[model samples]
Target: MEPNNDFEIFLVATPGLEAPLHAEAVEQGFADTKPVPGGVTCRGSWPEVWRANLCLRGANKVLVRLGGFPAVHLAQLDKRARKFPWAEFLRPDVPVKVEATSRKSRIYHAGAARQRIEVAITETLGAPVSSDAAVRVLLRIEKDLCTFSIDSSGEPLHKRGHKPAVAKAPMRETMAAMFLRECGFDGSEPVLDPMCGSGTFVIEAAEIALGLRPGRSRSFAFENLPSFDPNAWSSMRQQQPLAKPDVVFHGSDRNSGAIEASTKNADRAGVADFTMFQTRSVSDIKPPSDAAGLVIVNPPYGARIGDEKRLRSVYGSLGKVLQTKFKGWRIGIVTSNAGLARSTRLPLLPPGPIVDHGGTKIRLYQTGVLT
Candidate 1:
């Protein structure tokens, strides 16, 4: 690869949800998009990196895999690291954080490897090293091959910068957006989250419907890179005409605090006019008076809702509400327990594969338009 050549751009997807993210990448017209084990790989320039961070809703992070080489020992790694063109990718002024992982390799001390890379950047490239820096340089030593990549997303993309008041076990924006896409929601129909916590799903739905960019309110680490072009990027970041949806997205939660957080979050995200949040339990929740659309909920699967015995009643109420009141509306319920889902008694189709939610495993159980 040339000094300034485009490398592999990996759009990191949440584990077990790679297919939907890959589908999103392909739909977004990313060139040479192919889903790898941990992420979707594509080829694009630095501007493409910015665009990926800006537009890809399902990506957790965008990693630029600058080419790797075989290194059997720390000395060889040090020599090559010192010679690599860090000045081309990293600015001398911006601080950097170096993280490493070793798997089945001789140079297996991840801490030592990270230290060497950090020294190389600080000493050889004249950059300050910081553990908390937003721009991260990642080193992976696997089977004696050392690969380096840069994390373009300083904060996780799910932060969205606009939503600071989140409820317990809040669904990540990235995961919610993909689940929304998986449910065949393309901003054409209304969306409601009866168990909306912090309004992540509702806000994401409104953003999608309004054609708002997820990263619009956030700054990316890519802006600190050596290749960053402010003028071109600013011109590219120019807002497209937003679409006005015909139906309002809605979210309801039994907790008044959750309702407050959701409402405030929607306002910060600039989708307040397109969203409605209310304090209501599942039993009291009903579909909008006139609109029949998709009902997507992320209920508490753990003890937050209640003990297992008590949760059966809660799930049952949710199921009963959808079954009786939401006729002709589609439903997508995300939870960790199959039994809890079964208690809902809604005709749930087979769920998609299990998704990693922090440490817990969850799945989205879907239903067709209800009877």
Candidate 2:
């Protein structure tokens, strides 16, 4: 495969977040970005694929389509797979993990299809197949057409490889970045999270403000590909000069353990200089600066109604504190329960698209600059 050859690059997004991810892709200058059901598709070469994994904060995984063929039976699939130019993209020494999914097609046995592809790669391409390999080859046999792609991102982008500590039901960095975008935070102004868990939102805001790339400290699966150029990748990963922001991002929680975790995570992320985490209750929280910005919080809510009812007072206290202390700052509250959001009684606009945080469905209830 040519290093500059253009192909389909699929950016897997959290369900219900395709639009925001598409918008982020467009902003990052990806070619022909279009939002689909579970992801956004674009066309780019190998360098673009590497850059996508390196820079796109909202993408969960980046996949590059290798090639495909119409195969109706197992024999045809095996034949076509054996002829695939895998050596051009994959190294013989690198172990590869193959996974297959079949939908609405005659070749409905996913396990059988996966076995065939694995055999083809092992025998024809001379690459060992391992279930635990960092490099992944995905085969989707949909509608009798087999499409092969390589997962360019080894681990999920949200991992960031820096945060080792987390609070209960902590928000993911990818989701937090998109939600910050949805809240109209451009990283110029301060961001305060009163119920900050693990300091995800606060640290993310600080990083954005500092113009830091989310994947700067992590390694990607693309490094194992034959097309990878070490010198070029090293130059690309070299971070540009970053200027310190004038505003400081703030996070506060009642739990001292959460505060400690947030501090450690921030230091690891290299944004501790621009962030402040305090062990304080919602009612004790105060703005860090005179300038008005965004106060975004993902308050805790429960699955059971009784737990939800008990949390109403907590939500009410949060809303009351914000109303009394933060006059001009806008607010964004994330919760699974509409009732808990209603308890805030802030002048909220329509809630955003439902986002799947782990397994729970949550929405961002946003407000304009508060009165």
Candidate 3:
């Protein structure tokens, strides 16, 4: 069969959360979604790839798979690399970096494999390969099959280009987004992060609610690609809906510094006008004017926050506050320690799945009622 112009988009997520990421990709309009072990695969063009980078919140990075070919040895690898349409993706003036990883394949020497691919790209396309280049091309060899992909997103999408400072063990933007999706955030209702450390969850929630593109404020690696069409991208940008949201989004933290950070991040994301930040402990949390909304909390865990026993008490106190104050609201808690979460004493459904938070496995706990 002939190769199609379709680009394979890899939505990188925490290990074991590929299904959720795949569902998210489909929900965002990418038709064909296949769940991989550590990520999801979808087909699209360069524009769709760009849009995914802008819109996907649960993805760690967006990799554009260029092509795949069978290569058992260096000789086959070099020949296949030379045949790839390097000129179509890389410009002579733009420097490119080749990164390679090998597993269970004859191409054992990763450094040598990268050098061969780099030489092929430079010699065939007349483009200089530099280690410090802004444009990066990734090569993966598994079981004598080589897969090539271009890093469309320069920085990981989790960076979000807004958070300058983070509290101890802060939840990553991608993880927070996944938790929100698991909690059923459809961007229609209000979201609350009661223990909003640096405000990542609240900011991401507000951005989703307002239909703001996460990648709008950052530059992408694909912008330097040879086939990049600035005019088409501008047209796409112009066509994006600018509708404002009409729901209340609130975040509060016991630490004043965290509240300040949340406020700054929301402002930087241009959703500050729609989000409310306050320096209040979870014990003091009060529901916003809305009859029902989400209460998502990423509280201090044993790894980051010391004294698990005392923290359990804090969680118990939090449970009391939620049950007494907000009865009809939905509650979602992100925590690495399941026991700590159970300390809340709220009847929670079985956690959806485990996600990686800085190498620790975290799960979501939800209360049946908001209160």
Candidate 4:
């Protein structure tokens, strides 16, 4: 487990968005990337793991596969865990937490497996184990093979360490970044979200256009690892000059409070100079510039059964506005209800794959440039 040796690195994707996450990894030059069920896997050492945490906007978390072995039983697992080279990667001064998941294996009890590893780390490496430790070790036992990994991103990457204000049912920044990519956004065009709640889409678009690293404002769990090199990580985090897009990103909401929140968030993200938020209803929304760009909105799709019938008019109104004023601009609407999306009558292409958003299943309904 030397610092310079290549190991398996996993970038956890938002459930149902593995393809886009994998595409992002490849675009960012991560080597040997392959999309699996829950995430994308690649080969990288500690520096690559650190760069993934700092640069990739769509990754929910970056994990380093330390090593693994086969253990058919609990006693074997404990014996093997104690022999692991923990000191090579983990800091004895920093507390650690171990989480284990077992599937289709002889060691079926995940709790018992977790306990064995926790005891091994404390006793062998002299590192304290706590439930609330910022650094986490993940163990997965499947088909009698046990694999160990470290969570290099402490908090979820969606946190972004900024955005203190949020609105109801707000979009996660990671999801927003992927959705933007899915819409064919490449940081060269304006983006407008008419029903923007706390301005997640607008802020993300502005950051992309400005070439800002998503993790620039935050610290990461990899910083606590024994393999972490301060000088190398610092050089990796150094910023280039921000690009100034010709068009500015725009967001609007009928809720004045949401507008205030969006303004505050953009300021904190260092993209206020490139973004605009206003208190305006869907019908009042217009193209921010004469140039056509993207109109992506995450409108309210009611949770209750009868709410769709009531929201049809709202969707219809949005559709009518875009048809009349936003011709040639692309549109993407995110909602959980298919009927509500149909209500827009915006000639949407087939819906995207179902995406999990805070337990609700949603999809992206998009169209080519509005005709």
Q: What is the C-alpha lDDT of each candidate?
A: 0.90, 0.92, 0.83, 0.93
lDDT of 3 by residue, 119-225 (tens): 99889998888878888999999998898888888888898887787877788888888888888887877887888888888888888887777777787888898
Residue 194 of model 1, lDDT score = 92
Model 2 lDDT per residue over 56-134, tens place: 8899999999988999999999999999888888999999999999999999999999999999999997899998999
Q: What is the lDDT of candidate 3?
A: 0.83
lDDT of 1 by residue, 42-156 (tens): 9898888999999989999999987778898999998889988888889999999999999999998999988889988888889999978889999999999988899998889
By summed lDDT, which 10 consecutive residues of candidate 1 come out lowest? 299-308
Q: Give the CA lDDT, 0 to 100, for residue 262 in model 3.
A: 79
RMSD of 2: 1.5
- Pitting candidate 1 against candidate 4, the one with the higher lDDT is 4
- Model 2: lDDT equals 0.92
TM-score of each: 0.97, 0.97, 0.95, 0.98
Residues 46-93, candidate 4: write the lDDT tens digits.
889989999999999999898889999999999999999998879989
Superposition TM-score, candidate 2 onto the true structure: 0.97
- By TM-score: ranked, best first: 4, 2, 1, 3
Report the number of clashing residue pairs per model.
0, 0, 5, 0
Candidate 3 lDDT score at position 71: 91
Winner on lDDT between 2 and 3 is 2
